[model samples]
Target: MLEAANLTKKYKGLTAVDSYSLRVLPGRIHGLIGPNGAGKTTVFNMLTSLVEPTEGRVLFRGEPITGKRPDRIAKLGLARTFQNIRLFKELTVLDNILVAAQIHKQYGFFSAMLGLPSYTREEKALHHNAIRLLEEVGLAGLAHHKARSLSYGNQRKLEIARALALAPKLLLLDEPAAGMNPNESMELMGMIRSIRDRYDLSILVIEHDIPFVMQLCEHIQVLNYGQLIAEGNPEEVRSNPEVIKAYLGRSAEHA
Candidate 1:
């Protein structure tokens, strides 16, 4: 579970996020949506410690993690994917996941250099787990292929797979459906649900795809001009007057 209190971020004259607060319960999926420049990504950066907040704090499972290093936060069981795909283009897909799985290494570098039994054993286990993670995201068969060779949607899934290698308790996904076609988006929705149930994960996603968020998230929060405008179930948010006038506007009619 994660909780953010009065989170605010400013860059010189601009307040990117203003007093935004929200909580994600265990094993639940939550969505954050807003117009461009609404600071959705800024909130994520603050939560992950990629950027320090100008004010307020973040709690992950009750411990404050506001200024912790991103790797430290990840080691504590939080992982995230970027809006733009970030993959090691030249690495084999399996190797890309193997890189993330290094967090679970139980042996020292000397052990690895000497090919000690402990290092070999742990490395073998990580390989097995990486393959299993790739399979879960429907990319097992492409494990040996170069990461840059996958299709756009498949690349998105690969990023999620790499994040899963971290074995996170909470996952923050930024625009997971950004470039997917309708069919791919639907597949991703199903995959996300399966992951939540199978991994017992709590997900907080920031997505511009309205219908995708509406169908995937159990709870939704709307932001506009760096301020929270609405928070509710999909139906409640879809019908809220303030949300209609703010982020959704005329799009609400189609939504």
Candidate 2:
């Protein structure tokens, strides 16, 4: 459902993301893994049009969306969550989702000035949809609570809920399990799988947690030094020599 061809991103003398390409098929979870500074986030930025690719193109289905405005890409059914949580801290969980749903309603001066029947109906429907989304992500009890009041894991769930409010065909998630404990991460894995099947979503996930990605994704791509070095199913990627080397090098550094 999504494809990137020969994508590259550079900043002056440093090449952040070098000629990389990948495909995400409908209803499957695709994993992107790499050590720090391997340009994983840069790829996310390029695909979502947050940062213009220095070279190459991104195609949603068959049309080129490279360099399109972020809002335009979002309207075309692409949505993403950041590695670090990016919620409106002061807004209630329900309100955060409602704000996203309201973006889909058709509005004009007449609709606002006269309070047309269609406007009222749309508003009510959005509220219902937002409530449904909150329930789906297991945040119904916290619906009226400030976003900042939720625990870390619930915050991540809320972020996913907000993204799902966009009704995206392809969802890009960056490190959904970044700060979670083992139990939370395992629960997150289940949630991701459930949502993917329930919503018929195509997902491209960039995560550093190896075991989590191995168990949750159908395919994995490994990146190192700003380039894709390996791509395969879990076993193939896990046993690959280069992937082993990358992890081993990092382990040695920590030791």
TM-score each candidate. 0.97, 0.96
lDDT of 2 by residue, 1-255 (tens): 999999999899799999999888988999999999899999999999999999999999888999899988888899999999999989999999987776577877699789999888888888899888888889999999999999999999999999998889999999999999999999999988988988999999999999999999999999999999899999999888888888786442343
Q: Provide the global lDDT of candidate 1 against the true structure.
A: 0.94
Which candidate should be chosen as best, given lDDT against the real structure? 1
lDDT of each: 0.94, 0.91
TM-score of candidate 1 against the unseen true structure: 0.97
The superposed Cα distance between candidate 2 and the true structure at residue 206, in angstroms, equals 0.6
User: How big is the positional error of residue 78 in model 1, measured in Å on the Cα after superposition?
Assistant: 0.3
Q: How high a TM-score does candidate 2 get?
A: 0.96
